[model samples]
Target: MATPTTSTGASNKLLLAIIAIFLPPLAVALKEGLTGTFWLNLVLTLIFFIPGIIHALLVVL
Candidate 1:
């Protein structure tokens, strides 16, 4: 049995994970806000796209 909030959070995470595959920075920002993680993700994306995706996944999940 899952609480409503728990299920909703799971769904949100799934959606963000899908978005992270495409736009890692956006996904990080959505999950973590425009914080240092967001800045780091942007920098990682500029330096190497794959690292950015990996970082975003770590932050989100």
Candidate 2:
């Protein structure tokens, strides 16, 4: 018999989402590895906090 394995993707995303609530740019960077989207999120975060959180949630979750 083969042992069953569980995926951690969902839990990782949840953690990212929670991190996004506090630090949107960091979550984006972690998810995207400092890509363009991360840059955009950083800008948004710098401009406004709520939009940053929204963008992070959108990207992470």
Number of backbone collisions per candidate: 0, 0
Q: Give the residue spans of candidate 1 off by over 4 A.
A: none
Instruction: Report every candidate's CA lDDT.
Output: 0.96, 0.90
Give stretches of model 2 more than 4 Å off: 1-7
Question: Per-residue CA lDDT of candidate 2, range 21-47, in tens?
Answer: 999999999998989999999999999
lDDT of 1 by residue, 1-61 (tens): 9999999999999999999999999999998899999999999999999999999999989
The TM-score values for the models, in the order shown, are: 0.90, 0.84
Q: What number of backbone clashes does candidate 2 have, counting pairs of residues 3 or more apart or in separate chains?
A: 0
How far does residue 14 in candidate 1 sit from its true spot (Å)? 0.3
Alpha carbon lDDT at 17, candidate 1: 95
